[model samples]
Target: MANQVVSLSGETTQPSRADVVIIGGGIMGVSIAYHLASAGVRGVVVIERAALGSGSSAKPLGGVRATFSDPANVALGKRSLDAYKRFGEEFGADIGLRQVGYLFLCRSEAEVLDCEASVAVQNSFGSNSRMISGAEAARINPFLDPEVLLAASFSPQDGYAEPSRAVAAYAAAAQAAGVRFLTGTEVLAVETAAGSIRSVTTNRGTIRTDSVICAAGAWSRHVGQMVGVELPVTPVRRQIGMTRQQPQPYPEVPFTLDLSTTMYFHNYGNGMLLGISNQQAPGFGRDFSFEWLGEFNAAARICAPSLAEPDLEFGWAGLYENTPDHNALIGASDEVSGFFYATGFSGHGFLQGPAVGELVRDLYLGRQGFMDVSTFSVTRFHNDDETLVREVHII
Candidate 1:
């Protein structure tokens, strides 16, 4: 039976089969397909519940930085930076990637020392990251209020990109390389037999395949429930607000984050893009409300006062598929064989998508390409080994 192509209007075609079935169409899933296709692995199918990049991939602030307290995250960020640098040349699509650098504001002396140490580790891994004092940081970002900041770390190579464009680039490259995409289709269940996934039951139909990669983002926990695996990935609500078009002198400002309050903002053309992690309980659904906008406005005012009196353009709320640690889970599961998991990315999914693609390729081909992601395996959680990252700013 041929695989079915289901439309958003409840129209369904025939069923389909592939060698590998990807359960999500976000950046992680699409990039995985792109990498698989690049590696000469044909017959790959990507299934998305909604339009591509409509999940957490579309909602993040798109901060691409290598200034991490963890080594694994640093490696992932470095690999992703390499991919972003050569993306336009190889994929023939402008991902809107900019290298305006990232300014991480530090408030306390402890955070300043930690930032310096992190810069050392990042420099060891060939990253052009360095620690700067509050005075020096003010020179880089004049709009920042240096009185509250004790020190800061600036990474020139770390920047931001348009999430939608990045996802489009991956999708276009994957399609050009013969990867099949099934949008507007939901995965109903994971059909397994003898501890191995045989196929996936979807709204359109069943997709028979040998391997299944679950990159379902916020819905990843639900996807894992199909196989009776309780993934620690939970959906935490996050809100973002954008201002109306206003001419500003600093148009290319780097993505700025206040470590003290976890407030972040960046330049987005004429206006600014701002967001803060919601303090509300998890599971807020997808509704946009004034309450979230109020919180965002308050945070933005404290971080960047210029954005306080903007037109109040509007706000949006999305889920952050958080893991036990702030890091991502990117390895095979022990409960289910022939089933791989790449969901819990916290909030770094968009920037890390390309490297994750390469990682997925390495995992499929049985090769340890660049970084060993075994530390993020699901088995570690079961064995009472939780590797938690202590980064405070998670927006």
Candidate 2:
């Protein structure tokens, strides 16, 4: 179906109808809009509660990698990385995509084996990831404290990008492809009748649409509640801290992940960007805490001594729309027809946003996506299927 969204002439006038109404102006929503438009779907309207890319997509440490424990995630990573590589030429935007690679430091024999196993899976998917000794790891990233490391997995194809810029690129491309964007428009409620999406009521006005894709990121649960669907998605807070630019220059190295402590760091400008995962008491708290700084510093001292400096120049927090299994909920919802989801990516959402958009576009248009998306369906939780693909290499 070629859906065309009628462009709004003025700020007060809302788009009365659209083929597809996508909520959220972040990377996921914008990327989906772009893909759908590029695929010849017209009348695609993206509703953003705020300006584009201002949500969780803006707060990431900007790490993009294919070094995942799950094959599904690895495949998605590979596809997204491919897109990021050509993003500059394709989008006419420099997303600062640097393929400096990703180095994961393991501290124990068991962790070493786990790293080896993940690398094996990653390599099978053409990731070309390999295990390196502590000496080699230090050589790859000289800032690492080599004495405490057992081994590390390095994938040269993986790296980071300017996430906000990437979001802008997708949004611009979508706009140019005839996708209408409704910035500052809040989806008040998604109205349905006869078990199918009828229209979406927004703060501005009503938008009649056949399909509604909830790409609302951290606010997806609340959005799902509008249709009486209980999405198993929660917003977990994650924080990142940056050090003051050093007077002495540090070598630009690969983004390093300390597996044992869940602490990771990489070169950002002349300083370093670092963060850690707090599994306990994960909630909707987006406030940066000094309490966590102490823990992050301790981990940094052990893993990367150079980043152990007490003076954290600045820090911020963002929420990850996480699911129980830490995998994304892609495809249409089983409960409501025409209601689709491309959210709940845990922390990997920003990295996988583009590929996911393309995948969703494929499924929506009744075409085979780049990969099998059966593993990411929303019905898996409904079918009482307990054997979910649990991602091990998350930080």
Candidate 3:
């Protein structure tokens, strides 16, 4: 089954037909489009309501890691991490990937146990993650308060990258391979018949296609409803703050995270970036709030006391497409033919995007994937007896 997408003079005009209509021009859509096009599939159209990588993809300084307790997540992160390392070589894009590693601070005995367990799983996958003492953590990042830490987990391969660069790289590569992208085109509805997709209606025009890939990120649930599929994804606002250039030059440090509160900090430019998980604030609100700063500062005081001294500027606020288990929703729908999805990755989407692209390609081609994607099925949540998946190491 071959597909084709026709483009006019510029990228603004939407093609009336395509082999595949991918909703979302973020990391997942671009990656999947690249993989599909490079795999000899054509007529692919990626529709983004905003500019490429302008959504959640443009937000955070992307973190790439494999230090996860869940084996599937570890594999996905590991695969994507490997891809990110070679992104510059393959895609001709310098993503500014500095593999300074990830350091997780644990404050209690139970947290230490969980850290050890997570490291054990990570090491099993050849991630080379290990549990370290508070002193060792302090040695890695001098800004830390070593006196209060119990133990920490460190993975040398885990690091951060420039997301916009990666997104541009993938999108450019995909587009060069004859993929048409329609930016500022919102998907209004998905017309379906006989349990299969017919066309994807957008604000600009209609794209006639049997296959519709919902890579809509935080807005995935609304997209799912258009096709009578219930994608259990909720958008929760997460924020990060950046400190102005420090008076003293800051040393390069690992992506350090406090285990209890999921508060994290890493070296950025002359200063650093800090963030915390605000499970209290919910919804699609991308508005930056000062209300959460007090809680973040409180956590930073116990985790890394020195971070409190610097005046931090509120950074970007993006939505995390959360599921009940905080994992991901990836798979083809059984009921709705030609509907594939790779979304709801919580905060691990950027790191896992590459591997997920491969997974989605495999699913679309009816081939075997590198990892068992059975656990990531969208139907798992509906099964009462099923044990839901959870990615414990979140930062």
Candidate 4:
């Protein structure tokens, strides 16, 4: 762990030195840096191939909720929610977080039963989530079509936050506490010795560090290959669109998800944000086509008919770092000592960023006595322990 910063593009340049060198400047990487600096881990440097939040962190749908069927996810989400609730007061950055609650519509009786079981697990972890009939769901969200929903799971304490603002706040706070960020620096290789990471070779320069944390999001598998370790992460393309301002008396709404159609939407100022999943293969060549607009509009119409009206404003496509089980691969690996991972979040990274930051920090500092994250280890899949937690309304 050293403190010298060397220019990567210059010839005869010595490697930059840091106690912890984190690859990727997205929410996951930046958040981990923030927590590390907060825990007094000096000489920390985070390198991003592009600008901060330019990856999956910037493109998230911004849905924050603690209503999960898995106990581990519920705990993680609740911890993140608590951190978000106090973000403005603690970091002096207004993240635009709102606790308007989330309404998860259930289209079938089986879905209702599943939601009830999920609610029980959530309540066990002190989450204020519960199951409601379709009539009660209509009362919660006046604009919702009761005929389309059989039941709903409502969590009053969960909501959404501005992704860009959250990333800025974490980066700012970490910078204030002395975390170096190098944007436009891509990690080209991981120098290893005796089965441990010695340094990271990047496009800008080589970074010598005690440890390396791979938080590269969609590109995590590529980064993993650098250390001769295979990461079970893939990039899946997803699209989201926003509608133009419309004159309507819709009440203040939490992020809503239609379980029947896998569509989700939320208030985007005077307009609304809408999106749905694309059943396609993973690749880097697919352009963000306007052809997806038809599918988006149809999904929106089924969930919220008002949004289906004319005048859609903007649309974009992003990648979801998917794993075999729709969960993140956190913690260190035996295959590559001193190389840690916090990737494959399956689109839930933004909301869970803060908690992940703290968890990785604790792991690095040998202070993870309180958190039980044994289930999320990368070895679980290898051991044939594929206990997947399926949250049906992930859009």
Candidate 5:
């Protein structure tokens, strides 16, 4: 055991040297570690300030979907979805994956048109998503009132999984592959020389490495600043609630989301899991509040008028590593040699972790990645608005 961090095993003696040091022990970090080690890259180490998977990656019910307005995001999400389907076989970890599907409810003509275009984009990428009528949407989730919906989009391959379980699974497999975990080790500085990563100085110890990957989740901005890289990631709080089980089991339904209200729900235990983006939610908060419940109730009454809000006895808050356009930032840094990052996924990090890990690994090894991620580079923010990647179908 080494540096134990919150419900995690103690770490071994801190390493003084490594081939690569990844900041943050969340999904992206663990996934990159596992993928790199599995690819025969040795001497990889991951540093986390707190317990692994204790960040946004700890969100219990994480939705996984290939449904997106942008084709690149669709590719990333779809590839990761396929990887997650085989996680049990490859990583020997059951992530409680359920492909109950995702249904996006549109309430306005503009929303319906946008959803239709999004579905078209998804279908162009072989996602198998399609536009469905309000009646068909009702059949999938009886809780919704069809009369209020203009139209909807459905993706059968989209669903939810246990985020913490997936993170643990990847961390376990990575450790088994000889990847070191420096839990509770806060990164103080990313030392560089002649515009290249030399080592990382941490609270516990310094690890000399030629390469560094910043996957520090919501705190990625600070990590980037330490290396003179502008990561442009802002932390925004998002919350979720679980209802007390009911007397009778509710019928299983797809993870249903109302685009207009940014409210969503899915089956959880014998009741339901509810979540809604707080428009007035300030950035960077640690505690969950009942303040958002009023907004949640207002949206609930409109989206699912028949369903009563169950005794909301369970809930938690987590941050979203948001970027200006709500698209992920994943690429190697030209300013700092041997520096790579995959952050600012907004709310899509967990679903895209597997694909992003492989991309970063290829970039590290100087191999051509499966997809052209030049569009995701941090350098894009420096150029015109047209160069930046924007995702319209985000929560």
Candidate 6:
């Protein structure tokens, strides 16, 4: 198996030439490979530094929603939601898609207005997201402290899923569709000639490919750098913790998020998985900080008072590939002909993976995509035009 990689589908021999070589074996890469294979393009190869979904994809809170301020994001999310719903049936894999809904608490009038505006944007894209009063919020989620909340946004159509399982499902489907996934392989360099990607150099060996998609999540910048494209993605550390299994299981609840502190939590297995955004400068640090524990406790007390009691059974940190605007950078590169970007999703990459993969496949095949991804182009940052896509719900 030296020159071959084994996937759930079967043995995939190391290829000498591939039609497309996606950098990153996370959900984005596998999804792209799957969509491409489904489109009848078989020579697809996915290179992963570690195991699939081992990066930021593994650490997502798994909140899948279309309640976004950006129209492109909302459209992409709606498509992703549809794909996720049909995945289990189409691929014979249960993604554990629980439509528990997403409840966002807004404390201030401004935040409430923002939520209203975002809901409007989402609704325009066929998403049934709406702003609800505190009473309504409480009606949907009984455990919430409605008195403290000024307003909230709830979308029953939006929900959460098992991230690792989704990744595995996509990888399996992609492989079964004849996509080769090479794990434990680091891409050392991307060789280009005549303004197009020629091949990719990896730790194991070189694979010749005309197309390359940088879906490396937190490490996408490094992969882009190899091809002389400076991706605006920065890896920021976000911490998450889970409480011990309660003697009495928690009541079924939506994934609740506090707008003020960006603190969020939802049911995960037998424990409640919770996390908060770090205000410090962004870096590649993945070490979980004890200093964040106090902040988490304080935030939890206000947003989820019942979870205030200290019983942190486990904790970990992961990177958020953030851009200047926090919206994802998708589409083809302006400088490189065969290079594509599906990175800088901020914190919503996991939710957007399925749709983005299809979008990338469409773009690569020169077919019109399900949604117009012009707003997510990398040239947005450099262009003189002020019309750029911005996501208000970055949490």
lDDT accuracy of residue 232 in candidate 3? 94
TM-score of 5: 0.96
| Residue 77 error, candidate 4, Å | 0.5
Query: Could you give me the TM-score of model 1 versus the true structure?
Result: 0.92
Compare candidates 1 and 2 on TM-score and give the better one: 2
Alpha-carbon local distance difference test for all models: 0.78, 0.83, 0.85, 0.80, 0.87, 0.82
lDDT of 3 by residue, 114-144 (tens): 8899898998888988988899999999988
Write candidate 4's Cα lDDT for 291-394 as tens digits.
66676668766656766643667766778888877888888888878888999899889888889888999888877534687777878777654364444336
RMSD score of candidate 1 (Å): 4.3
Instruction: Please list all clashing residue pairs in model 1, or write none if there are none.
Output: 2-15, 2-16, 3-14, 3-15, 3-16, 4-14, 4-15
The TM-score of predicted model 6 comes to: 0.94
Distance from true position, residue 47, model 6, in Å? Answer: 0.5
What RMSD does model 3 have? 4.4
lDDT of 1 by residue, 1-395 (tens): 01112122233342567899898888898899999998999888888878878887765347787778777888898889888889789877776778999998998888888888889889989999888888887788776777777889999998987677777778877877877788878888888898888998888888888888999988888888888787788788877777676755445678888876677778766777776676767773877766665665676566567665557576667778887766788887677887888988888887788898899888988888788888777666676543443353365
lDDT of 5 at 278: 68
Candidate 3 clashes between residue pairs 3 or more apart in a chain or in different chains: 4-43, 5-43
Full candidate order by lDDT, most accurate first? 5, 3, 2, 6, 4, 1
Q: lDDT score of model 4?
A: 0.80
Instruction: Give TM per candidate.
Output: 0.92, 0.94, 0.95, 0.92, 0.96, 0.94
lDDT of 2 at 389: 51
